[model samples]
Target: MAQDNSKSELKLTKYNNILHTKIYRIEINDYQIVELIALKNGEYDGYLINCIWKINKNQNRTKSITQKIKIQNLTVKKLMAELENGKFETIPDCQDLKGCIEGLDGTTISFYVYKENISRNYSYWEPESDYYYKDKIIPEILQIREILKSINHEFDLRTSFAEFRDNLPKGKYTYGMVIIEKK
Candidate 1:
């Protein structure tokens, strides 16, 4: 009988053991704002700001309201698969990642990965041009963006700094990914 080597030839990573994940969108105008949170368990929650009243012809008041939605199991599974295929487990430790480029601003994307006692947070600015950004980060980000698009949960990439500055009280916008160990 021939000895089987197929199992040994395959390389498995920690992502295989992932039970849950969460993605957060952090935006900063004058302060920090967590605009959205998406979990691997299909729970998606966030806050949306809407104009509540007009203070003047050129001014308006806005209110932040909480919103909750769920991703279909199939879409969640697809997202997980995309992450796995993106080699998320192979990503270097946060400390080892090359610092992001300056002047790259928009929404701050953050990924929180959790397994048991081990939790890691990977945050990045949009349109990073660093070496690691081109080689590793971009691929993962692209995967995430594709998944989000497929699920109709696309990130707000149209917001500009001027808009953020003009509507400081309305809060900034951002989006990203997270993974956590399932209970």
Candidate 2:
């Protein structure tokens, strides 16, 4: 069953209000990255990087797109102000991932947020593992992912992730996603 998230969405501060994020993900055949950054002056920058190495590593195809998008939305603005005003405190670090405990080899997801001076990441071993679905999913993390995904809708940043998740071969597969924070 899909977990209830409405109440969790109301409390972004409960987890943390983030502005910049760097999501690095790995799967059996590909590696992808999503970066989102926002500065104190209200400037926003984003990038989507995808690398799919076929069965033959030498035949790898990589695509990287960079954009300094102009976003105009009140909900986005309010979310930003919440960061600056402290209604949402910045989550300087990643949460401890507790969902990857089955076969020793499975998919792993590591989400992170970094600053000029430091970086932190949250990791989940494999969404297909025994303990995978049991983890206390963070509604805030999911919210941030959606926000970033929406901002980069033109790039079609999410379809591939969903595809990969849906096509996982059993060994230990998981969904892939990322939300970047920028200060």
Candidate 3:
């Protein structure tokens, strides 16, 4: 199985011992990453990670820091409802991804649904605007983003990362991955 949250080591989940469907979205660019994972039982995990390396003045090395917060069951029902409301199953593949050029800067949004017998993942390579405010799967994905962002906002995620993305130094960064690395 491919690592959903792009890291070499596995990050243990609260319900890793149980059976449950996992629904998630990762909104990321060069500067920062915002991700949210929701379970059917209302367990949600979120992260606000900075892609730019931190100074780490004392250690003499730069590092990435992930600010994680766990929110219980408040928004999962609403999020799952949005996905059920003719959104996830009906949403078509993205056109931009098929003809996307590599090496150009743009925000990539990926959504996933995983379970014992179900595995679905969709991604888009946008032209980089609006933080997906006007996404094709609006009302569905837009609301999803809102809920995810709200969870991430608890960790201080920004309304926009475009403002100072270039002002920081790049480091170990992975899009759509739940980073647990501290080195």
Candidate 4:
């Protein structure tokens, strides 16, 4: 009988834990730049900004990812602030948080948190919308997914290191994947 080589244990490093993942220090200034680019040419006009951020493996890596999110008829500032402050732990209903604002740094802002009971009437533009995960979260997952995929490896998206921040209706700092996995 052949031995169960697949069951053999591989050496794990201390950095494998979530606590070991690296976090970069970013400020409002860093976000101002991205907000400018995303808004240039009126690319995201009607869509209200939602979340922005990134993920990482540990503190030793350099380079990280950035994200920008916008949703139709959704709260801009409150949603952005909630996500920034780690509110909801997961994405909340579009109607649950509602308010209105002029803009952030010249960008228009609005509010529209969802009501869980109301239920959406339209089909999802993106299949993943069913999940609480945000678009900003997807790309970061893809970065790791692509890397692991290329190497014929598999990883758990849930376990992946991710961090995000946003400035709704305009300006936001939605990246920082540096420190989890390296390029």
Candidate 5:
């Protein structure tokens, strides 16, 4: 069955060492790769994100694995490099975050989050338009748009305004979303 086929293709290994590593087997189509990453915060002991990434590709099979990490212990220039490298996203614009990025050899990495949009013809209601969503939504929309542009314009930034907006809080300005433009 399709479900069993999917299940058989997935494998995960847990390493509870002091270094905090977990390995995963990922299969898509006929390709498969094994990967791992470090966990931080109070999150999952050692797993950083819900998804694992291939850090390096070796012989089309093995790769150094990685996961999204907060821009906690890196630097601004470093963070930009990581963004270019697709390691982290949305570097916060605050003193702590600035310090976090600045702490790592002047090179900090950050992680970004994105979601797909599903609203019907929501583009028509975009801030630039007068479609009448609300006066307040415009600020949020502009904020999100600026973030999207910063991420997409340089440093190999990946993600879009539509994807960002769809993930915003339905009716309020949640501090959770931020635009991390490389300075």
Candidate 6:
């Protein structure tokens, strides 16, 4: 099956007291793997996270599969509280954060703020460690992973790269990407 690469606008019609909005878009095109939409919506009532992954590396196109998972109100309040505390802000010195991890590879991670209409993206090699990643990335990743586990979506993270990739499951063969957008 063919994948749709077009962009679509997000509509918010459910909750009126939208505390903030976050959109995470991860894309790794090394082996024709694209995960373009990972949206996390945090409102006064609850939270909603929608993630989609597409893998098309097989020679036989019919063997490819697209995985879509929706997580609703499962520890979203904790995530929202973290965001409210400014845990996603970029650190002043990238080198300091790098010390926490070793042997960085060629992966890309992005953080977009919908309310401010600003985005900050960097590759694995660019920063020593990301402020947002250090502060709340792990918890955020674990939150989703735990939820995924409960629903029988299991994947392993053997290396640092794998750990990072597993945090955001949207990619194909050699490369993986994860986007975190907060308003």
Best by lDDT: 3
What lDDT is obtained when candidate 6 is compared to the true structure?
A: 0.32
lDDT of 6 by residue, 112-134 (tens): 23333545432132222354356
lDDT score, candidate 4, position 161: 20
TM-score (C-alpha, index-matched) for candidate 4: 0.16
Report the C-alpha lDDT of model 1 over 33-139, residue by residue, as the tens digit: 33333445655444322111213323332222222233344544555455556554344433354553333344444444544555565544453334436655545
lDDT of 5 by residue, 1-183 (tens): 013332233433333444332222112112221122333332221111222212222312222122322323233233234333532233333233211111212111222232122111111112223333343343434443453344335322223223433443323221112222211
What TM-score does each of the candidates earn? 0.40, 0.39, 0.50, 0.16, 0.19, 0.35
**Cα lDDT listed for each candidate:** 0.36, 0.36, 0.44, 0.23, 0.27, 0.32
Best-to-worst order by lDDT is 3, 1, 2, 6, 5, 4
Off by over 4 Å in 3: 1-18, 30-52, 55-62, 96-103, 127-157, 160-183
Can you write out model 2's per-residue Cα lDDT over 40-151, one digit (the tens) per residue?
4565544344432212233222222212223344434443443334312343223333322433344444444445444555443443332444546554445434434443
Best by TM-score: 3
RMSD of each: 16.0, 13.2, 7.8, 21.1, 18.7, 11.3
* Candidate 2 Cα deviation (angstroms), residue 117: 3.2
Better of 1 and 4 by TM-score: 1
User: How much lDDT does candidate 4 score?
Assistant: 0.23
Rank all candidate structures by their TM-score, best first, as comma-separated numbers.
3, 1, 2, 6, 5, 4
lDDT of 2 at 177: 31
